[model samples]
Target: MYSEIIRLKELGLNISQIARHLDISRNTVYQYGNLNPDEYNQVLEDMQTRQKKLDHKREKILSWLKEYPDLSGAQVFDWLKERYPEIDISESTVRNYVSYLRKEYDIPKTIHKRDHEAIEDPPQGHQMQVDFGEEKLKNAQGNLVRLWFIAFVLSNSRQKYVEWLDRPFTTEDVIKMHENAFFFYGGRTKEIVYDQDHLILTSENSGDLILTHEFANYTRKRGFLIYMCRKQDPQSKGRIENVVGFVKKNFAKHRTFFNLERLNEDCLAWLERTGNGKKHNTTKKIPAEMFALEKPHLLPVYEKLNSTCKNSITRTVRKDNTIWFMGNRYSVPLGTYDGTEKVVEVMKVQENILVISDLETKQELARHTISLEKGKLVKNNNHGRDRSKGIDKYIETVAVFFNQPSQAKEWLKKIRAQKPRYIRDQLQMLQRSIEDVDVLITEKALNYCLKHNLFSATDFNDAIDYFGKMQPKERITRFGEADFIEIKPLNEMDRSKFETKPMTRDFNYYKEILERGHIC
Candidate 1:
């Protein structure tokens, strides 16, 4: 072929004219024309020898295909592509080369990989791939729980981000995963390619694409487009599909977690250690290292897409007037003093604190301490016992006339039995009598009534009035010298023994009739 092209070029033929005559590449014709006749003859001989060698290899491939008709030509071509070092040929050329060999060596043609199309290359940063996988966990009951982990990987960098959540692969999880992927990528991609699920992209009976409202909002907010492959056509996002298998085999295999949060933390750490740490297969650089370079140039994360998740639940106060949180209950102000429904705003910070507030007005009333102990009810000890009404206050009230420690103890015990009720009236009655009578006599009356159960101050006053009217009663001014029997009655019978004289002076008849049952 080179000699023929050289001969044609010697006859004043251009490269295109020589290529037409020789039916070869223009460059090959040009090279042939540039060569001397001796060199051209040597190239033609080498080409003929190479063609013979290819004929032998092609005959062997064809013979193998004839013997095993199940074998595909593309499979043989793949083998030849790897086996033949000197041959640089396209599949078509190889096919034609094999056909010529079949004609010369008497072999057969086999099936070719004509039905399959070459995979299309994804545009850089144009698509994000997502999938789901499983991880195992031990629940509170110690039973094994299989958790679903949502995974997303950039098609270009193979930078993967994952989350292990107890919630199913629902709409919320899908949206949340997308949000996290954007943040993980430090920006948005031109398009998000996802598995065709009802949570994300669904087809209605009417043939309309029923995209989730939240996902639509996300796309609109981030200025990114969405892409969904045909059902079951996993090749649509083969990047993440392969990533899914990679993660399952490497990170998730034989792994056990106690909680979803801990697993997610581990997943992220693994992503940093493996996904972003190693050189990519195609790029020959670390995925994480490449991601860093790609991140700054990607579209910025949308400000409207909130990353926070809020949880709201209602709680009630226990009998101890404390609301339970986390595991413990802490006291709010007693009575919720403001009335109506009282609420506790539990803001989770370093620890959890209940912002005690009046629900009617939402006014913050008090801030209680954070609690963690389960079922632990923390009381407001300072307010539980009102210090203003302490035992000392009651003791000081009675210490005025009773000044004796023994009498004060007795009075305090009696008053405590009645609680704070009626204690002031009893103290006032004692102070009034202390001024008119000797302290000893008033103390005697108090002890007599306490012993005989005449706790009423009015009954004690009647006894004192009766004793004052006694006829010709010998009196001792000094407390120690006074007639002790008259001053202080020892028993109930003794108290009744001293009575008013019958028919005091002259009672009016009508007034007497009103007291007809009386001895007077």
Candidate 2:
């Protein structure tokens, strides 16, 4: 206070000493310190009104400041300019008001918070961090497509690897990224970190590391330590977080990629040119320079790492003699073949390899090269032959025949890869001779038609049924019942009465019999 300063000066306080004590200017002290009684009273009143106005301003600014404690004064000024036009304000005015509120209200110091996972003094080659960022783009069709970009950074050197994916994040995606990152770095680090991806864990907040089972197995096999950031804590893995922005801004900015693969290739090229090649801000040496020191500490590239692969979950074959994977038709090895009740593991790990492995034995029973289009069924190999009218119907019949593999094996071996025509021929032959004989006789007959021409399994079945009904019945060994069998040729009385002509032993005659619909 200026009046208090005059009182202190009369008590022998020097101008320099009084100014410093009251945190005021020496000019102000000299002007007010010598004021007469009336003038000093007037000065005191003026000081009170100014102080009251300042106090009101301080309270107003502080009340607004409370809404955005982390915001800067300039930013607050901008916000106030747009939101509170009635409140006359300036950046300095807001700043001074906030300063006064801080002193008067005793607010605590503010610090920019970061995740505890970030190391204060990171050791070279000690840790590598991984994270994913998303970008929006228009594809060739001019439709918006979202691409996922995964980045890995070395803490000390800041060397990085970035890749793009068109699909949503998956545990498989995470593992593949790590594999490629290790290859890119030429070694593995002692510790690696990841975010809360479902493929990793649903929710890891309780301090329990609930990693996906597959991911756990993968890390355990590789002997790498994995750490995840606390939920909503970005500063925890600041190295990767910074690299994500750096790579995107520097490399991905104006560039366009046709697909995920091309985008990833571009990302790799950019990472090498920007993040890895440039000198790091904190390290003071180029990343390539600091990376050399970390090189030897990393684990040597694993030879078997090349074998790791991924397949999209699209197809599934169920246990009920039906195939239901990715909403497509795929045949099993046939007939209640219990390959363990576990879900079918469709191995799309490599290029289009579809392996149906038995869950219990972990043995693959069926495999086919899948066409690229999803839901397109490659006929199941277990359906060995086609003795049917059409390809699909033939597949269905073969599927039925294999329902009794042992019984069908003899027939199947003969017609391992027969065409529908041969099967149709066989059916015509079987039905022609069934006119005068018992149809049940034809049912039991095992006439193996092994030819590629008969691509009709349905025809083969009909023929088998026809012959099955024609044969004479021998006595049932188990039931002790004498089963009557149908005789195809004429008996003595019928033979003598009309010398009737039977079917000639010729393929054309069989064809004639089929055209006439002799057998239903």
Best by TM-score: 2
Per-model lDDT: 0.63, 0.64
Give per-residue CA lDDT, model 1, range 214-253, as digits (tens): 4555566567776777787786677888787878878877
Please list the residue runs of candidate 1 whose C-alpha ends up more than 4 Å from where it truly belongs after superposition.
Answer: 1-123, 137-143, 204-208, 302-304, 307-520
Which TM-score value belongs to model 2?
Answer: 0.42
lDDT of 2 by residue, 1-520 (tens): 7568867988998999999999999999888878888998897788776753345445556776676566566765676677767776567976665566667776643768744543364676678888888777777777777677888888877788887888655556777777888888888888888876555653464787755445676888889888888878787777788888886678766566587778777777766777788778876778877788878888776754432434422223455444555446566666534564333434554565667655335566677665656676667745544324353343334433232435444454344345334654543443354333332332243333333334344655565665654533542322335455445655445555476678669789879989889666
TM-score computed on alpha carbons, candidate 1? 0.37
| Window of ten residues with lowest summed lDDT in model 2 | 307-316
Total colliding residue pairs, candidate 1: 1
- Clash pairs, candidate 1, are 276-288
